[model samples]
Target: MSRATVHFLLRSDLERLFTTLTDNQYEIIGPTVKDGAVLYTPIQHSEQLPQGWQQLQAPGAYRMTRDNSQRYFAWANGPQALKPWLFAPREIIWQAERQPDGSLQFSEPAQPDRKLAFIGLRNCDLAALKLQDQHFLQGQYRDPYYAARRKGLLLIAVNCSHPADTCFCASTGDGPHAKADSEQPGFDLCLTELDDGFLVQSGSEPGDQLLEQLPVSPTTENQLHQQLQQALQAAKQQRALPSLPIKDLLAERRDHPQWDDIAERCLACGNCTQVCPTCFCHAEGEQVSLNSAVSEHTREWASCFSEGHGYMAGHQARPGIRERYQQWMTHKLSYWHDQYGRSGCTGCGRCTTWCPAAIDFPLEVSRICGDDE
Candidate 1:
């Protein structure tokens, strides 16, 4: 946690880091360009990382372009976050079988048997992971599946130096820079990629052990200063949220015309929730065998925009797109504060960048609250 413990890692040594993780039997999952978009995927070597590639993102727009710069993680974020790695999109909770005596037997599914070392995790996404932990791990009834996957998870957080057009972590206090401490429920190691090398700090005991195995030199004060400056510059470059209190603004503006305005532009396709790192809604169903002798209960990711999401016994509460949109926004911006003592959104801007409608929530908030400045 001390600045004295920070170290410098040369660009060439990145391969060594990956090798070390692989030697420790950790599956290395990091960012790579695939199918014209930056996505988190499995990587065996450091070369698999999307180096010198940057992304241009806007409302309803995303394009990958070459940056010519030697930076490895210049792009702020990709479509995937730490969510899927922890909370699987689809998982079988339990299965049941017909016994020999015509009785039913049920058992929980086996947990995944892999230790994951997640690389290129941004600070905002890291915060989202903690928020998810609050929901799945810290609840009265803990989610066994999520807990099992989270147990051996190692987070390697990257400090943001290149923010996207829609990013606003600066306003949400989630991040443009990773928190420089290990005591928090965040990354095991925090990395700041510089022109020539990376400024690395251990946030956990495993991170310290990994650092011990790597070829690294003590970081200089000048390098640390530059790291801080770059992070601050990234924060400055990101879009700023409205000056008004967001929770209060949304709470009082339930009847505001902005909901209707957004509904008009919103496709209700649920792309935002799907890409959002913090959205944890899911639906469970039981699948029966043809003979109805065996059944498997499975849970998969669900969206608030789904028409059935608001259905009751005989009626639907949010039958209209406007109500569905309102529910999504209000739950993210206002109700989440009451439930978790924090806003649900991390300001990572994935929703805006990937949305077909290009509906930027921060811009919408600014317009709704009349905070032009």
Candidate 2:
């Protein structure tokens, strides 16, 4: 669809959007303030959203403050992305039961049937979801659970007009502004928040239907120009990538000394992977009853920082924190390109913000790549 088809929604009618989704039986999940941070939570109405709230995020630090600017989503990105909602942290893949004849019966567990509509998804998160889809849905062995949850998934992407201090989505080419192409696997509806209203564009058929129900009018050319300018300004405020080619630089810097430096400050707490939108590493194990009568196979999110993650027959592949951290960085920045034809990271900066050790990835990349030059 052309940009001319885009519409403008008055700020007062925001609640109508929520009501429309609810009327369609779509559970709206959006950003809300909870426990001193903006978190993605279920919201029944627009009032539940974090209004006039802003978050200051840096390595090993996060502070939420009141903006009082009438902006509902002044915060860039939060601790959790779309990952936890789509790919559950802990899920039972299959279950087994003991029969009277002493034979075990195996059956797949029922998947969640809830219809989820993600509101306020940033452009980078939409890209991360696509990357995740390549692994879970497009792979040879499709995950039935993920497929079920993804079937009726709805995305309402919000363009990043206020990039965080730790954000580098502009450098990674994943965000700052949501993609406008209708053919892309992007948002159903993309919204650019202006001072008084939103410049909204629909990317899919369902989004068009929703837009038809909203109180909106055709967006003016001047409004579209201002929207583009705001996105450009946001991109300029984000952290920039290093001058060197990251994929090649990291691939060749396997033995860089900076890895050891990072390992020293690293707590191996797995907070980075936990908050990373694209990190999909997981481990599966079986839970058995006391009498071993029944066993349930379960899968949960795993971290490369975990010691046992790299365990083999008799030894750990990455016995040291240096090796483990190196493996994670390499896989995310370099090897992922080889496997998926794109970088795994969306540059949301959640990893740096949530890390207790305050490890900055952009600084690390510059250190390693710049040292070689």
Candidate 3:
């Protein structure tokens, strides 16, 4: 409500903000239409932001349509989120070269740290980002790549105005509006999309300083509340995960018949894991040159559903789809609490949206844990 903290930005003002980010040497990345989907790409201008285009997402379904509206950030989430940016899908951790003197030299690629500003971050994405930070930063072995990228990063979040049918971030308490508490800061700059303009708020010191440079007009408390009502109501989504913490309950139902039922429709193609915002499993291997002169150690995203994911002593622990599905579900709702002190799922519904076989995990969880009763 305060003039210094909250402001209104017109279309031209957004362009000015883009210009400011460029001048500050921040690589601006935002949502743009690519290959029939909204994807994060280098944004040079405000016009690159997906405008008048919205998505229809349901279980195992995603399609784009033109609504002829004058609003950006009016659609549900796409296939990806901030996970791929911070926790890269594929990265070379280190490399080794065979030496002439029968000794090997180990080296890492010297890619300079980049100052990145990610725009159009959703509330669920912000929640997912927090979980990612916990995984990569709070662990015994902090990932240098994630730590370096996260340090100089700026997040410009957009409040959800168009939650999809598959979304359940509300039930997860992550929600339509991103929460920034005294303990943990959320986004750098948060925006609520409106028809004529955007309602902006600074969530961090950097955001405050950045907003000072933008061409934004002061907004009143009444105006802010009135406009924010719709975004808050967007949290009342059609889908919701169980409100209760079924961590222990899910573990007890390891042999639930529901697993078999869901597995029949599941292809175990790992589509859900790949699209999920918080799934963090990865496969690491060494890539050796044909001449044995060079070796590169790489880490790439992996899924529990992968046949090789549960390999131990030349035998697959979860070779069947039912076991794999059970493992994925339990880790998300049960094991995550033990690991991160909270659920791993952000309820962005990307897994539900992109799963080719239409395996709706939320409904499946209810059925498996007997929460539907």
Best by TM-score: 2
Residue-level lDDT tens digits of model 3 in 113-172: 899999999988988988998889999999888888888889999888889899998888
For candidate 2, the per-residue lDDT at 241 reads: 68
* TM-score between candidate 3 and the true structure: 0.95
Local distance difference test values of all predictions, in order? 0.88, 0.88, 0.86
What TM-score, computed on C-alpha atoms, does each candidate reach? 0.95, 0.96, 0.95
Write model 2 residue lDDT over 1-373, tens digit each, in one string. 4433778999999999999999989999989999998789888989888888888888889998895699887888888879998899999888899999999899998778998899999999999999999999998989888889989889999898888999999989888988886477488888899988898888888888888888988878889899989987899855766767789989998878898899899999999999999999999999999998889999999999999899989988999999988988889988899999988988899888999999998888888888654
- The number of clashing residue pairs in each candidate reads 1, 0, 0
Model 1: per-residue lDDT, tens digit, 267-327? 9999999999999999999999999988999999999999988898989999988899888
Error of 2 at 50 (Å): 0.6
Residue 13 Cα positional deviation in candidate 1, in Å, after optimal superposition = 0.8
Which sections of candidate 1 miss by over 4 Å?
1-4, 371-373
- Residue 253 miss distance in model 3 (angstroms): 1.2
